[model samples]
Target: MKPGRPRMKNDEKQNLLSAGDNRHRRTEQEEDEELLSESTKTTNVCVRFDDSPSGLGKTLQTISLLGYMKHYRNIPGPHMVLVPKSTLYNWMNEFKRWVPSLRAVCLIGSREQRNALIRDVLLPGEWDVCVTSYEMLIIEKAVFKKFNWRYLVIDEAHRIKNEKSKLSEIVREFKTTNRLLLTGTPLQNNLHELWALLNFLLPDVFNSSEDFDSWFDTNNCLGDTKLVERLHTVLRPFLLRRIKADVEKSLLPKKEIKMYVGLSKMQREW
Candidate 1:
């Protein structure tokens, strides 16, 4: 049999994780140490991007960033990635394939199954990142809010365009130090929708919709070149837009293959 790394007993694991529990009381010395350390910690902001062509490696870039933070920056995180239900497994697979060094866990399954996972893995801090579906987050939000996440990433972030959305509201309540929003499409909708994303990223700066509108009034001048340029200037610091053709020249051009098959008589009838 192949040997494996040592595994901790569940009781030992729970005891170790409990030390970092948010509810644990801290001594005055510990608080002072934290205050001193805060100044040296680099603040991470929301990384928002759009206008990228399909297959532009958005997911790959995000995975690499998490890997970098964990391995190089020494920020072995308890990150949370909220993705569409359809892509939950795919994200977990990519994390394992590309950055196996970082422990990635998926919070999924039935209510009973999920509860067991939370008790055994999630609460024990056995993972560096937790990848879960939007629906699962809704169901187990309270459990998630317990962690002070290093990064809160949302795939298909357009789902939170509406500030009033349940997902948006719930995500805003998460105790996360950094956030990343990944979307394949541009914010072609109204400015308010764009503000929703910004608000989630930097609530202090983009706190009021009225204020945002007053600065960039696109109500009557949607096509105003100056307005577009100004908006780009504001977004340049936080946004990164890239195209596959521009950055991925080494990749071969896409090729299509078509196959045709006749349906059986019974299948066609159905």
Candidate 2:
């Protein structure tokens, strides 16, 4: 979980987008063009937010996309988002505040309650999105398996840096085809970290550790051009990254830093 500064809650959930919401309709061509994104053509919107303003604007865009697409196609969603425990709460507060029309169930509660919600209340045929945390997945994997989820989102995915970690291996085992990861540190300090992330992002594309090295060549930290090409070919469409400072440089402060050396008293005397 990451550090957070909480916001005031109004308890008023906004009607962000209505399914089959004909309120603001678009043209067929417009719909088709948007649909070409192909992966996220669901009643929900899933995005990986980077430091970019577009990253922050995903929720609004998701609402817009959902409005345009779900309007064209008569659909009711069980659109789900799985995030960190800390972020899950933020998502709950944000979703309620911004998208009241969309139903969201927070899955970070006690195991009994979560299990109860999963078994009794969260009817896959009826309930909308369920916002859950990764740590809860081990606790609620069986409950999660109940639904044929339209979307899956893993925020701060860098937590799964080690391929050997139970959480890391377990996350990749989930069945959702449409996956979005939101992170500032998508990769660990090393390129192997990138491999672990890519493994989940696109399975078998990188294939094995041998293939990863032949393809990625992270030993020297200089990128393998072919690796970049392969990434563009196989996994390019799914991943989108917007680093901080990409947009709105004016809003943040800019400072130049320099490393300085000081002489010891004996050296100064000499």
Best candidate per lDDT, number? 1
Candidate 1 C-alpha lDDT tens digits along 42-91: 55443444554445387777888889887656677878889999998889
Q: Write the per-residue lDDT of candidate 2 for residues 1-270, one digit (tens) a residue.
A: 110111112321122122232211223443455366554645435444433335445444444433332344433344556666766677777767766666667766776777677656575333456777778887777656544344566667787767789877666655443555666664533657777777766654544756665555565335466656765565455566555565445566778899899999999999
Per TM-score, the best of the predicted structures is 1
Minimum summed lDDT over a 10-residue window in model 1 is located at: 1-10
C-alpha-based local distance difference test score of model 1: 0.76
User: How much is 63 displaced in model 2, in angstroms?
Assistant: 6.5
Evaluate candidate 2 by giving its C-alpha RMSD to the native, one decimal.
Answer: 12.7
Q: TM-score for model 2?
A: 0.66
